[model samples]
Target: MSIQDTVDEMAPLRPENRHGTDPLMVLNGIRQEFPSSRGRTVHALDGVTLTVERGETLGIVGESGCGKSTLARAALLLRRPTSGEVFFDGKDALSMRGGALRSHRKRAQMVFQDPNDSLDPRYRVQRSVAEPLRAAGVSRADAAERAMAALAQVGVPEDAAWRHPHEFSGGQRQRIAIARAIATEPELVVLDEPTSALDVSIQAQILNLLLELQERQQLTYMFISHNLAVIRHLSHRVAVMYLGRIVEVGPAADVLANPLHPYTTALISAVPEPEATKRERIVLTGDLPSPASRPTGCAFASRCWLATEQCRTEAPPLTTTAMSEPGSGHLVACHRPAEAQEALASGLQLTA
Candidate 1:
């Protein structure tokens, strides 16, 4: 069957698939690809599998074009996957129709980056936040009331609600974006680099605000970013993506402290430390390979220091290694797992 047919078959709002013990959101072998000329395809996401526990923050970090946003869109069901399944609260996430889909919409919302563009410039903050509720059948007066509450929840002053988006600073505008996202009291909010465009100080404020809101509202998050330090602070677990595939995933502390994949290690090493005396950077060679024609064995093999002949000929599946698993699961895709570990320990400086 075609990808669209597969999507149509999965029922995202069924009760049977919604009662998992741990996960509130699950992505099973999800894949997304865009067709290219010459009978090729750009593999944006390849067989990604992960889960989000209720009220947990899961950070997804990767280089640009590694499908971070695409993954987020898949979870939101905004961008249908080319293959695989999404289970939310035990139901197929791709099959809901009409009211079911509409109800589910309130359950999952997205906080986009760039408040300036995300919020309609012409719409006042009150109307912008009220838009979702209005769409869900809320009365105009009631929607306005809910919009004000949402604004307060995100730290916006009451007076600002009547003002246009341009009336506020970038940080306040982002808070407005957050208000719109939470107006419906969504259980899961896919945060797509919500703070990346803000100033450093503002980023911290937004992060703290998100954490506070999550705790207060018991919200689950799929936080996507390229910033390791931000991920370390916000995530309960971290999944590292490279070339559209997750090469390493585990508890945030464990994966950040001892990254398993070569790409992950290189990424972690690039994070600047406060103590200059203790810092040693690992610079990988070459630019990120294009997704249209990925490497045969490992997508990361071209830039991987420990890659061998086997790595070039056989693809590695996401699997557990013998080193030691973190409390939450930590998985890696590499033929020479030990060698990857040795490279991490030796602080091997990658060469071109």
Candidate 2:
């Protein structure tokens, strides 16, 4: 069957694939390795397994070098993973090439971290927005009509569409970028820090715009960022990464309010809270281990204060705990779940 046929056969809005329906996208055992100097291989993404359900935002949060960006690229098939599976809309994405890949690309789009990186200085905003459609064989006149509509949806006026990207502010550039992403009416949009480059107030506007767009189109999103607060705002589900592995994942409210993984707790602790919502800070002492020479067991074991000898010797598999959150079950890969929870229960005074 054709890729479009496969898409047509499936029903949408099924969460966690409970009803035997396929989600928008699924990544299994995705690994991206880069050859470093001195014959060392840097494991950018090490066995990442994730899913983005239809019409829901799955936020990926991690520190720099935790393979968040690499994950995004791998998932989008922009850069194929060193080894793994990428299934989009129930079709084998990694297997697609030529026309199949091209057809599938229409259903999935990406909005990058910096609009400057995506927009061309030479092209006007209208051409930039219409480029994807033109590539898909849409006539110039039709592409322009769709592009104008998309720009209007993102609050970019018809007048601004004729101007160059340099003529717009940073925030406006991002809106144009978003317009280009949705012009094809993609089912999934991988937003890789789409608002990180903008000012704080502008950040809120961009986020609100994204939410509005998603609602209007029933779009799925794989939103990646290091900012937990922003993730909390835009995500329906959250995945926390440490050293190229998912340490924890669940509904946004449950995972943030009651994190089961030590790494997630440390991340949440770092977020400044008001006096009434003050949390016990758990200071992680050691620097993040180099991905080129990762630890033998749990990636975060060295810096995890609650880690035991077992955590050092054996890597923990991501498993569903008794502490699963509502709507979505929580998955955590920590050997010492009880101790990790205890550390937060008691006023965590000691440093890792």
The candidate maximizing TM-score is 2
> Per-residue lDDT tens digits of candidate 1, residues 83-174?
99998888998888888888888889999989998999999889999999987888999989999999999999899988998888999999
Error of 2 at 278 (Å): 7.1
Q: How close is candidate 1 to the true structure, as a TM-score?
A: 0.91
| Residue 76 shift from truth in candidate 1, angstroms | 0.5
Task: Score candidate 2 by lDDT.
Answer: 0.85
Residue-level error in angstroms, candidate 2, position 219: 0.6
lDDT, residue 105, candidate 2: 84
**TM-score on alpha carbons, each prediction:** 0.91, 0.92
